[model samples]
Target: MGRSRVALKFNLGRGVLLAPLIFLTIFYFYPLVSILSVSLFPAGRIDLSGFSEIATSAYYHRIVWFTIRQAIISTVLTILLALPCAYLFARYRFPGRSILLALTTLPFVLPPVVVAIAFTSLIGRGGLLNRLLMSQLGLSSPPLQFEQTFAIIIIVHVFYNFSIALRMMTGFWMNQSRRIEEAARVMGAHGWRLWWTIYLPILRPVIAASGILVFIFTFTSFGVILILGGVRFATIEVEIYRQTTSIFNLPLAAALSLLQIAIMTAMMLAYTRLQRNLPLELQATRHTLQNLSTRRAYTLIILLVSFIAMMIFTPLLALVVRSFMSSTSGTFSLRFYKMLTVNTRSSILFVPPVDAIINSVKFAFITTLLASVLGMMAAYLLARRGVFFARWIDPLFMLPLATSAVTLGFGFIIALDEPPLNLRTSPMLIPIAHTLVALPFVVRSLLPALRRIPPNIPEAARMLGASPVSVWWLVELPLMLRSLVVGAVFAFTISMGEFGASLFIARPETPTLPVAIFRLFSRPGAESAGQALALSVILMGVSFVSFLVIERLRTPGTGEF
Candidate 1:
């Protein structure tokens, strides 16, 4: 009887594991299969025409090469910028270090559209410096045209990806013992010699991992290229968007989407293998903070300060300054902001900006809740490592994220819109799509937190005559809350600025903020575009403040939950 009960329990656990697998097969794989089916077997015949088109097209090849070239440049630049800064943040502690670190990380949480908008505000023709130059020096022509250039795209990619390198590498750096640095210092090594000999060698693997991750992200980038490069520069994603929606060529679009998936899958497979070997143990160093007194030290500090100031402050000031300036007058005015927030239109379909804001907030809330709960379940199930179906189930949730937005959007349109259930027009689909992508992040984020919880704590609680619920509430809930909140914030932020899926799933009647911004920017004039820029700032500001509050709550030296 006891054996039968154990078998029953095992079966029940197996069923629980299959829950997400079922969801994955239905929502994730089915949509992909549907796309492939439609593409390859359209008109009831298998066809290689789509693939042939991609193979023969020089335009497609050029776009692919351009994207790879730009992504490589951005990745290299980001690593160069991140390595020294990450080393400083991890190995040293000076006055205002924490604040500086936080500021440096600002670009990471800001939405892609938001970052692109900020860059445009700062560097576009007739922007802050250009206007100033014209006014002061009587210059008739602007020196730089940031829009529709490859360089601008690369700059935007670097701005967004630089922090990933810093954060990941810094975590690796923090785990290293100070004895290595100390020994190097004792051996007549100072400044560059010490970092080159002792630190850089040890940090290679971490730097490589971070670089690979950032490269994949930048390589598959769509938002930065579209807004910054305008119509001239096209990545695979941009091409896919143009081919499918703009030009209405489904075959070529399908081909590009498949090619993107193949490339991304290859990259992801390599990254996952590398990740398995990653050094997960991050030990806290106990060395006292160093003080800067020498002239060399002062020079190094000045350079570091200037770099940070230029990277963080300049772009932000440019964003705000441009937001205040009218593109018409090429002078500062607060009218754009006013036009953004003060919406007087009274139509249910074309709702006000305030309605979009409220819709976005609500969608973010629901998605965050769903992602956190589902992610916790998935993580808990995977942690056990004994379930029969766990191996197959684990990677399924990440499929939505690995697949390109254009493909997923196409998939969602095909799969969900027709059936016993039509979710195409439903506003809930936006949050659902956002949750699908954000769920993987929450799972990844919370897994480490859940692993850190000792098994014995719950057992001890249960041994003391406490029920399972009581044990969970008393011992596990308190410990996991902070990490859960962090994970939820990530979900919320991603949902708030979600574009790819939102483009397809969002209703004409109830558009998310990103969708609204895109709509406004796609029009004919600077008024709408400038207003879009203002909305982008508002979005970035909200996410930034939320992240700041969360970071403050989780400050170093604060006791763990």
Candidate 2:
């Protein structure tokens, strides 16, 4: 009878795992299968025309080459630029370190569209600097001329991904035994010599993980390229968006998406494997941190910190400045912000701009709930021991992250039209779509926390007359609360700023903030641009609050993300 009961309990545990699996199957794989079906076998017949065109066309070859070339450049430059700064963060106990680190990370979470808006306010033809130059130098035309340039694209890409390199490397570096640096110095090794022999090998795994993750992010960049790079530059993601919307070529769009997925999947798989090898041991950062006593060290810290602030914060500052500047004059005004409440568009479907904020908040709450619940379940499943499918299952949760948001959005439109899942038109699909994108992040945030909980704690509770459910509720849940809140905050932030998928699926009347800002920018006028900037500022503020929460709660230098 005891054997039968154990067997029954085992079956029940296994049965519980099916919840997340079923959700994944229904939402993730099914949409992907729809894309695959449409791309390869459109109109109930096999179709290779799109693939053939891609292979034969020189234009596409340029697009493909440019995408690869730019992503490579961005990743290499981000690492080169961020590594030294990360060294400071890893080694120093400095003033405002927590706030500075939080701000540095703030960019990575800000929507790409917001980043683009911020840059436009800083350097675009009608930007603050241009206007200042025009007034001071008596110039009729903007002198910066930085618009749509290759250099600007690279600059923004580096800006967006710099935090990933900084945070990841700093976290890994903090845990390294300081004795290694000491021993290397004792051998008369200095600077590059020390790096080559000691630091390079020690930091290689983290560098690889950071580089590959940033590479994937840059490779699939859509919003920055679309807004700042303009029509001249197009990544695969941008091209996918173009093909689907402007060209109305579903097959071609699907083909580009497939090509993108193939590349991203290979990179994500490499990252996952690398992540598995990253040191999981948590060491207190205080042991490695030191006071900066040397004048030279202080000078370097000040210079680097200033540069980071200039790079990361200036654009956002300019965004705020631009949003307040009156459209008709250079004087400050709140008209643009007030314009959010006014419907300037001459259409029945257009709602007040403020509704977008309300919708975003509402959808974000739903997404936070759904994603947190599913992510916790998924994390638990992945954290389980002795499962044969563990290796494959971990990557499956991550595939959504690797997949293009454009493709995912398009897949939803086509795949969810039938009964029992005919949610293509429903507002609930917005949160559901958001849940898919946010799930990976939510899972990643929780997994580290979950794994850190010792098995004996729960076992001890059970041994002390606690039921299985009670053990989890009373003992395990409290330990996980911080991580769970972090994950939920991630979900809320990502959902609030989500642009790509929301662009494709968001209803005309119920646009999210990013979608609303994008729509506003599509029209040409000072009023439109000002309102867009204003909305972007609001969105950035939301991200800032979320960042503060993460900075407060996250285990310093030990975050899995």
Candidate 3:
């Protein structure tokens, strides 16, 4: 009877595993394989020529070099900027500190296109900085022309990714053992020596993890480059879209896609290894922020806070300001907001702009439901078991997070066109793709909470004559409710702001908010630009509310990203 029960349990676990495995295979792996096959067998035969052409071409070589260079520069700049802020947040408490931290994270949830537009509004040729410079200097032309430059690209990448470095490193730093630092100080190590010998070694792993994540994100950047960098600059992601959609070069697109996936997969593997090797005891000790005590400290803190405030808030403020300004009057007005309700016959969009909000919210709701359910199951399985399968399964679930959305969207176009699972024109594909991207976040949020539940609580319930299902429903469910909410919010916001996949899959008549904003920006005229800014403000509002809920619900010290 015991043997039979063990076999039953094994079968149940295997069945649970099969659901996600099949979903990933159909939606993720199959699409990837389709792209590879198209590239390698372009003419119903094996073709090594595409790979050779990519390798030998000087244009492709320059692109590859630029991608790596920009990513590295962005990563370094983000870390440098984020370190001081992280130190301040981790070690010093002040008025409105939590609010400041939350504000710093706002950019993370904004769409890359919105971010690109915001930066352009602040520093483009006709932007605020140039206008100010021209008016003050009496120049006919705008002097600060930053558009399409390497410097502008790097600056925007840092703006978009700085929060990751800040949050991750701050959480890690707050939980670190301060005894090492104290010990080094006592042993005559001070200033740079103390940092170089003690803090640096302890923080290396976290820095590495944060750097790798930032690099992966910047490497796959698409919307930002496309909107801000213009035709002169293209990442692998932007080039993939151009090659596939505009130029109709499928073989080259597939080859580039393959190269991107290979590099990202390697980086993800390295990140997984680093995470595993991180010291478990680093989480044992916790630190409280200290009150500012010295004049020097106050000066430093004020300067850092001001810099962070300016860096994060300026672009958003500019965007909001631009949204209200009327093109004809050059004064603040509600014209753009009112224009969103109008369904002009001459509009490029098939539907009114307001309908895009409805579509975005609808898709986000469905994505939250699907991602939460699947992510909960995956997290439960990993937390409840300590088997060989669990070891490999964790990384497999994270693969989607590391994969480029542009590549995944391209893959979907090619792979899901046939009969058994045709989803080409189906609106359902947007939610499905969004769910894939959001699943990793949901799993990350829930896994920690699930793991925190004491094993004895469930065992105690069983001892009191409760069935396994009853124990799970009565105990585990209640305990994990907050985390579940956090996960759902994350999934919702991700779906709402999703741009890359939606770009490929969305129909003309049923555009989501991000898609609508992109469309608005694609057209010329001040009216279109104003509408784009207005829609972006709406998207930003939604994301901010979602993030506030996440902040209220998330457990302290649990890393979000």
Candidate 4:
């Protein structure tokens, strides 16, 4: 009886792994493998010709170089800008500090298409700054020409990723032992010497981790490069899209996808190794914000805060302003918003613009449900099990995160077109793709909460004659509710904003908000452009509300992406 009970428990534990494993295999790995096989076995025989073509081409070489170079520059700039903000957040507290921290994370969740539109309204040829300069200086043409330049790409990348560095570094800094700094001070180290010797060395691992994450994100950039860079610039992601959609060259697209996967895998491995080497530090006993005691400190704090507020809000503000202002009338009105509900006979979209919001909400709701369940299972398998397989399974869950969504979307187009697995035209594909992107976040959030539950508590419940399900319901569920809510919110917001994958799979009649916005922006008309901005604002509002609710419900000291 004892042996039978032990075997039953073991099987139950392993059973939780099955759902996520099967889901990833059929939806994620199968699609990727299909793409690779098509590239290598073009004529039903193995060939290296596709890769050879990419190797010998100078155009491809420049693209590869540009991708790395831009990512490096973006990473460096983001870190430099984020360090001061990280220091401020770690060492001081001010009024509305929590609110400010929450706001800083807004850009991170906004769709790339929304971000591109926001920046264009801020600095593009007909953008606010350019128009102001042209009118004020009496120039025939707009000045501050930043669009389609390397500078704009770097700027946008920094805007999107600055929060990652700030949050990670600040969280790490707050938990650090202050004893080392005090010891160094007593040994006569001060100012630059103290910082250079003490803080930099300690912060190295976290810095590397943050940099690697940012690099990986920027390396797979799609919407930002395509919309902002225009025809002149093409990252690996942009090229892949072009090869697949415009040029009808699936072999080349497949080759590029393989290369992208290889590079991302290498970076992820480095990140894992560095994470292992990160020094464990005790949580601070108490966290309190310091008041500014010196004039210089007060001045610096005010200036920095103001600048950060401007950087974060200006573009979004421009988007809102442009959405309301009529280009033809040169005045503010509710015309663009009203147009959303009015179906036009000549419009490219088959349905009214507001319908896209309905579609997006439906997709987000389904994705949240699916990701939460799968992620909870994965988290339980990792945190509750003592099995050796859990070690490898943890990283497998993160592989979808590292792979580019554009690449995954492309794979879906090719891989799911025929046979028993044909899901290319299915409405379910959009939610499935979004869930893959959101699963990592769900696992990350739930894993920490699960680990915090002491084993003895569950054992005590069992000793009291409670069944496994009863113990979970009576003891574990309430404790994990906050984390579950956070994960669900993240999944919902990510799905709502997801663009790259949705672009490929979303049917015109049932377009999600991002896809609708992209189509609107691509067309040549002032009304369509204004409608795009209005839709973007709505998308941003949805994400913001979700995040605020998550913030209120989150467990204190739980880290967020």
Candidate 5:
């Protein structure tokens, strides 16, 4: 009787595990594998012709080099900019520090379309900068036209990715016990020597991890390059979008997408190799914030905070102003908000910003649900280390994140758009596209929670003759509810603003919010443009709400399931 109960418990665990595997096979793996096959294999044959076109084409070679070079510059700049900020935020306590941290993190989550429009109104030819430059600065010509330039691309990329480096480094830095630093200072290490010897070495793993993540994100970046990058530049992602969507050269687009995947996969593999030797035993100490009292240190901190505030707030403020104030008419009106509710335009592509809001909310909710469930299951299975299909399944979930969404979108166009699948035009495709992008976050967020559960609890429960369902219901599930909720929220927000994959898969009738905002900017008319800005404002609000809600949900003492 005891053995039979144990067998039943094991069977229940296995069944719970298999549920996610089955889910992935249907929604995630099948779509991704099918897409991969379609991209590389031409019709009935495996061929190198697609790759050959990419390798041999001078245009593609230029794009590949530009992509690598810009990403490197962006990564390095982001690290430089983020490191000091991270140090300040993690170590120092001051008035409005929490507010400052929140402000810095705000832009990272805003929709790419919104960011692009905000950037355009600030720096474009007829933008505020140029107007100020010509009128106030006594300039005959505009000195700062960053549109379509590499400088613009790099700045935008840096602005977007700075938080990645900051968050990772700050988390790692805050975890560090001050004892080592105190010991180093006591041993006569001072100034740069202290940082060089004590802090740098300790921060190396975190730095490397953050750098790798930022590099991957910028390397495969799509939306920034597409709108802000304009005509002068084309990354592999932009090239794929242009070739496939605009030109209808699906074959060439597939080739470019495959090349991008190959490059990214190779780069990730190299990073993994380097990261393997990194020591993980350095644990963090519990933190209580400290004040910067020294004259020079306080001055420096103030300067850094001021610069970050300006960098983050100025463009966003410009966006807010443009959303409310009229640029073309040079007057203020509530028409933008009204237009958001009532689509006054006759364009076939126009979705009222209000409708887009509903669509975005629905899509985000579905994505959160699907990604959270799959991720929780996968994390549980992998945490055990000896679980069935663990090794094979883990990498598959991460592929969507590591690979460019443009590549995946291109793959989807080729694979699922056809008869055997024919899911390309389905309204559900956008949610699926979002889930693909959000799956990695789900897995990463849940892994720690899963690992925190002690193996002994289940064992003890089983020894007490608890049934299989009861053990999990009474033991494991209780510990995981918070993690699952946190992961779900991340998945939702990520999907809501997701742009790259949506570009290829989203149909005209069921456009997501980001897609709607882009369509607004694609043509002319000041009212429509302001409506887009207002919609962007709405997006920013939605993103902020989601982020705050998730933070609250993830907070300890709050029961979230």
Candidate 6:
């Protein structure tokens, strides 16, 4: 009876793998195969003709170089800028620490429109800072124009990815045993010497893990580059978009997509390997946290807090203020909010922003449900030691995240071209695309919680005559409630903010909020800008709500999240 029960549990864990595998095969792998077929194997014949064109083209080479170069620069800058704050977070406990830590996850959920509008409100030509400078100095031209520059792109990439480094490093640092540090101090090793000798080596794994995540994000980055980069710069993602939309070269677009996938898959394999080597030994971090011991310590804490506040929160505040202010009268008003309800011109694409909000919420609900179910199952399956295939399958699940949504969308167009699979025009395609994008995040968030569960408890429950279902539902589910909420919140917010794939898949009349914001921002005139800012503010509110949920429910010492 006992041996049979153990077999049942193993079978249950192995069975959990089937859902994620099937979902990936249909939505992820099938789309890739279809695009490759259409692009390189048209009429069942191999085609290197398109390859020659891209190879000989100087512009394509520059794009490939630019993609890798920017990602490397962005990853390095984010690590440098975030490490001090990570140390402060790991070593010290202070007022507003919870809130500050929560802020780290906010950027991941926020729409690109909000970040773009926030930066514009703070530093653009007519931005508050530039306005103040121009008025004080009586200058004819605005001094702070960063609309299409390389520096601004780097800054935004840093702004978006800084949290990845801080969160991962802080978590890893917190869980570390400080025996080495204590011994080093006793031997008179101090400051830079101590850090260079002991700390850097210990942190090498997590640093590489977080750096790879940032690199992958910036490597295939689409929305940020398109919104801020202009014609001066283009990544591989942007080049694919232009080739598909402007040049109508599907074959070249497919080739680029394949290249991105190959590189990203290799990097993801490395990340997963590093993740396994990461220390999982949990200890109470409160015991490790120190109070302000010296004047210099207090100064360092204050400086770190201030920098985080300025870098992360100031632009959001600026965006909120800008949204409320009227463009024409330059006074506090609700004109832009009112503009969302009006469609006087009766344009075919002019769905009211209100409807866009409704559409986003509706689709987000479906995405949250689907992604949570698949992600939770995948996490649970991997947490089981009996499942050997989980090792290879785990990294494969992350490929959806590494590949650009543009490539995925292109794949969808080619793959679902037949009847019954003809989901290309269906409204359900919106949520389907969103679920593909949001699934990896859900899996990442919940996997830690699943792994943190003690093995002894399950064995005890089984001995007490509890079935595997009872052991999970009555015991494990409650323990995982917080992580479950975090995962769902991430899925919902990601779906709400998704742009690149949504732009490709969403019908003109059924636009999502991000799509609407892009439309409004693209047009000239103060009214359009005002409307875009207002819509951006709405999206920002959703991100804040996600942040609060995560902050309230977070349990540390689980993993290097």
What do the candidate models score in CA lDDT, each in turn? 0.73, 0.86, 0.85, 0.86, 0.75, 0.85
- Who wins the lDDT comparison? 2
Off by over 4 Å in 3: 1-8, 279-281, 293-297, 344-349
lDDT of 5 by residue, 1-561 (tens): 869767975886787678876765765556556555655675767867767777798978899999999989999999989888887877877876655655666677676788888888888777778878899989888778788888888988888888767866776677678888999999999989998999888878768767877888899888998888878888888888888778986667766766677777766655544433332323345566778788876987889778886787778877887788765586787778887866657767656678877888899988888887777777777677466566555565566777887776776666676676788778888887888788777876676666667788888998898876788799988888777777887788788788778777777777778888888877588877888898888887777776666555553211111
TM-score, structure 4 vs. true:
0.95
Candidate 3: lDDT over CA atoms? 0.85
TM-score of each: 0.90, 0.96, 0.96, 0.95, 0.91, 0.96
Please give, for residues 66-99, the per-residue lDDT of candidate 4 as tens digits: 9999999999999888877887877776766676
Q: Residue 241 error for model 3, in Å?
A: 0.8
**Which scores higher on lDDT, 1 or 3?**
3
lDDT at 335 for candidate 2? 91
Please tell me which model should have the higher TM-score, number 1 or number 2: 2
Clashes of 5: 2
Tell me how far the alpha carbon of residue 50 in candidate 6 is from the true structure, in angstroms, after superposition: 2.3
Check candidate 1 and list the clashing pairs.
Answer: 148-229
In candidate 3, how many Å is residue 234 off?
1.2
Please list the residue runs of candidate 1 whose C-alpha ends up more than 4 Å from where it truly belongs after superposition: 1-16, 188-190, 279-302, 326-333, 341-349, 385-395, 554-561
lDDT of 6 by residue, 1-561 (tens): 869867986677666878888988988899999878867886679996667776899988899999999999999999988877888888887887878887766776666766888898999888988988999999999999899899989999999999878888888888888887889999999999987998888788888999998999989888889888989899989988998899998888888888888899999999988887674434423346888888988999889878988998888888988989977677999988999887745676578888999999999999999999999899888787777777888898788888888898888888886876889889999999999999988888888888878999887998798887899899999988898888888889889999889988889889999998988888887878888888999987887777777767766644445
Which ranges of candidate 6 are over 4 A from the true structure?
Answer: 1-7, 280-286
Better of 4 and 5 by lDDT: 4
- Error (Å) of candidate 2 at residue 321 is 0.7
User: Over 4 Å off in model 4, which ranges?
Assistant: 276-279, 282-286, 291-297, 344-349
| Residue-level lDDT for 289 in candidate 4 | 57
